[model samples]
Target: MSRVTILVYKGFQVLDATGPAAAFEIAGHFGAPYSIRLASLEGGRVASSSGIAVETVPLAEALQCELLLIPGADNPLRAARQKELLTAIADAARSGRRVASVCSGAFILAAAGLLEGRRAATHWAAVEALKRLHPRTVVDAESIFVEDRGVWTSAGVVAGIDLALALIGRDHGDELARKVAQKMVVYHRRPGTQPQHSALLDMVTPDNRFAPLLAWARARLSEPLSVERLAKEAALSVRQFTRAFTQATGVAPAKAIERLRVEAARAAIEAGADSLEEVARRTGFGNGDRMRRAFVRITGQPPLVARTGARREPGMRG
Candidate 1:
């Protein structure tokens, strides 16, 4: 069996640790070889940011695991200052064990010197802060998760589960990973290259009036979402629909459609879709040039750049 250790510290995000642990544990139930344990710098009950306490063994006893996962805390920079913790993490990586982090937990790895000159992913909101703090580390704001050499990093919250699924797929097989996802009722393992944010979610507030209309548009991206059609779908005059959508989403109707289209196109590109022209045609962009322009305008990068970055191999060093 492969031992998996999750290291936690005070004020850590609870789900960042538990979500991946549950995925591994579920995979184990289906005949996958995984043994999980929670650990901390010292043995005892450690309280998470949410005030839920988890029992943990001392880090020393958990250091020999095949995979070591560090969970993000509400104030990760505070945890990053723990000298003994940093030393232990550095020593573990030097010993050839695979190490991974969830969300701001990447701050801990970077502090331990494991992420220098490596591509890493963290919560989109923290991307600028991570870049400023660790100039040597390549911070990928778009990807849901990233694996550089033997070290992995994932975006905020539920993304830890995605990272764990990827690891399970790598260790066992895609079929086992799919089974695990089915048992958990999540989409069958979103690729590591998948974008962390969704345009639909970003644009719609919980109580937005146009939420249903936006959802309808998202489900039919290939269909022309002209203002007239959306107005008719929402059962409002074209002028009223345009005004209301702009008020609810803070973007004009046309801009919202473009954002949604670009998001879909980017997802397809990163997921290894066959051709940009096909992706554009499928996502309502009509052609590759139009899609490329929209991509650059909204994402500050062309679709080709996204495809290339998604396919880039990890460096030799961990």
Candidate 2:
């Protein structure tokens, strides 16, 4: 069995640590070979960002392993500065075992000099921060996970499960990985190459400046949604509205509108709604072919593939 030691720290994101831990446990339950342990620098009770506490061994007790995972914390930037923690991670990296990180935990790895000149991934929201903080690291916000050299980093939350699945696939095989994912009720095991961003999440900005316009546009998707029309709704001229929308949301009005449409179409498809052409029309895609094109461009898959996979999933859909 591969001894898997996951590092924990105060303020750690509970899901970041526990989600991958659950995946490994489920994989082991299905007869995969992984002996998992949790360790922190000081050892004992670790407070998570979610207000829960978990016990951990001292870093000395769990220094070396076949794999060492560092899960992200709510304040990873702050956590990464701890000299003892960085030293422990550096020692683990030097032990010649595979080292990986989840979410903003990549910041820890980078601080330990483990991710220099390597392609890495982290929470999409933290991509800019990671890049700005670690110029030597190549950050890919578009990816669910990335592996370079012997180090792996996964983008936020549930992506850590995908990273664990990848580790299972690496140790065993794809079939075993799929089985473990199924047992965890994760349904589809999204590949590392899958995009980190969800169009729906990207479109649903909090305190959105164009929230009113977006809501209005969503209700009238099939209606002509020209930039001029959107500007009028926002009480601005087209140029002003375009600039403001792009600055606030990092997406232009047209792209944001398309994302909203895709979200609607995807919901319909997942619900087993029949008639692709009809779905497209109702979702403002004009036609099935156009919808297919949009899905391919935005989601890296055709609507048929996504819908079929969603229907065939045995448990929670990815």
RMSD of each: 4.2, 6.3
TM-score of each model, in listed order: 0.81, 0.70
With candidate 1 superimposed using the best TM-score fit, by how many Å does residue 123's alpha carbon deviate from the native?
0.9
- Which candidate has the highest TM-score of all? 1
- Report the lDDT of model 2 for residue 88: 80
Writing each residue's lDDT as its tens digit, candidate 1 over 194-245 gives 7787888889976888888888899999988899999999999999988988
lDDT of 2 at 36: 90
131 Cα displacement, candidate 2 (Å): 1.2
Model 1: residues with Cα > 4 Å off, grouped in runs: 202-212, 220-224, 233-236, 239-255, 258-318
**For residues 1-318, could you state the per-residue lDDT of candidate 2 as single tens digits?**
888999998899989988888888888887886889999888999989988999899888887688899999778978788988898888877878889999999999999999899999999889999999999999987877888878989999898998888788778776787788788888445656556655645666757777667878888877778899889888998999999989888888898888888877876776557789999999888999999988887778888886776434322233
Residue 215 alpha-carbon offset, candidate 2, angstroms: 11
lDDT top scorer: 1
